[model samples]
Target: MFDWTRSCAYDEQQKRRFHTTARSRLKKLAAELALPPGSYDVRSNKAGVAVSGEVTLHHTAVYIQVGQFGMSSGHGILIRTCKGRKNYTGGANHFVALSMLDDIPALAAAVRAITGVGRADADSADRRAA
Candidate 1:
């Protein structure tokens, strides 16, 4: 005999586990990037969990949100970014879904690309000043 109550309890437990896992992963990534402690906020959403924070990569300042939804292994990470108050009034400018748990490397690569451009611009400015 299948017990619906037991199934519900199991689902709740799994959701809690996913929330904790997602929160920890985001925190770890932020720490690795040297973001200020407590710069991000994690919360439970329709998705298993979600995290949002401001990240300045290169000279671009953007707000980012990552969310994980679903209980299946097929669940992936969703990233959304917004620049300036446009996030609130105009909405996000970018969105992507990464279908892997090990997306940290991809995230890091993006940051490097942005920062690399910033560095180039700074170098050009320095040369002009000299």
Candidate 2:
């Protein structure tokens, strides 16, 4: 004797668990991408902490900024190719909520395109483009 209602409940629980696990994994990946294997500087600002680093994408050097919010619980990262851009001034233009870690790769690719750093790795960029 199979109970349809009970099966539906089980499916809902499984979906919830899968979502939770996926979110956690995405956050971990975001942290890893936030810091590459290189030297970076951390500076404090009134709003949050800013991380300045250099990233080489497609053999082009670009300046990166990863900002961690101090006043708020959430954090953000901004990667740019140009230095002293008014858009990123005070960390306004190139901002992505840390809570949306799952979409970080897409965001990064978009930034790279805007900064004219050449397209990112085909496979990696494909996922976001799709």
Candidate 3:
């Protein structure tokens, strides 16, 4: 429960709980992907008094919103990589919501595409081309 009426919006305890919930969801996907340690970090951003009402996955090129607290976000994950990334029909740069555990597989794929962690990098691509 986040208190938006307060100046800081949330307390240290609330912050820890929020982060834990977010990270646990992410870790479940990470375990599936076998991502190496420190492959990603869950950082916070300001959104009025709600500290991290919005979150970024270490990339500014894309945006994501993890739904929680029965807010409009719901219990889903939103990602903005839906130009042929998944079955999403959203416009380019628009976030597609995957709101259930059944969508985890799709979410996992979306996560990989957005983060570029499990995907081959420039060097690997170059080596393959050579």
Candidate 4:
């Protein structure tokens, strides 16, 4: 038997872990944006793999892609949402490359600009939904 129960449990654990990691990464962002962490929803398609996985922020309407950095092969995060993609390293509007877990103040600001939705508004909407 493949033990689907165990597999499901493992998958859920991985998802939770990824969400936790995402929460940690977004903690400061939530503060800066004045958005509540509970209002942010996270989903991963790569079994919540720490590297090369896709994590989508559904409620916040953001996508986080983490994997090998360009040219350097170092780990980094690439945010994909709205119209274009933001690489780990690129122009001023581009994402920042990370050899490790780097804070995302700039990225969050970029997201704010791209989404054109303020945290206060998002927070209000989330509260209304709740």
Please list the C-alpha lDDT of all candidates, in the order they appear: 0.39, 0.38, 0.47, 0.46
Clashes of 3: 0
Regions more than 4 Å wrong, model 2: 1-60, 70-75, 83-93, 124-130
Residues 68-104 of candidate 1: C-alpha lDDT, one tens digit per residue: 3222433244333434333432233344343332465
Clashes of 1: 0
* Deviation from native of the Cα of residue 70 in model 1, angstroms: 8.4
TM-score per model over all chains: 0.46, 0.34, 0.42, 0.42
User: Tens digits of per-residue lDDT for model 4 on 1-130?
Assistant: 1111112223556545544565456555546556556655544555434333444444344444443334254434555443222322322333545422343555566656655533544665698799
Spell out the clash pairs found in candidate 4: 88-96, 88-97
Ranking by TM-score: 1, 3, 4, 2
Q: For residues 30-102, write the lDDT of model 2, one tens digit per residue.
A: 3444534332332223221122121112112344443233215343444445443222333224554434434
Q: Which ten residues in a row have the lowest lDDT in candidate 4?
A: 1-10
- lDDT per residue for candidate 3 within 4-109, as digits (tens), equals 2222345656555555555556556555545565544445444544554644343223334553333344434555532322323332442445343244456666
**Candidate 3 overall lDDT versus native:** 0.47
Model 3 is weakest, by summed lDDT over 10 consecutive residues, at: 82-91
Name the best candidate (by TM-score). 1
Point out the higher-scoring one by lDDT: 3 or 4. 3
Candidate 1, residue 103: how far the Cα is off, in Å = 4.8
Model 4, backbone clash pairs (residues 3+ apart or across chains), number: 2
Q: Candidate 1, overall lDDT?
A: 0.39
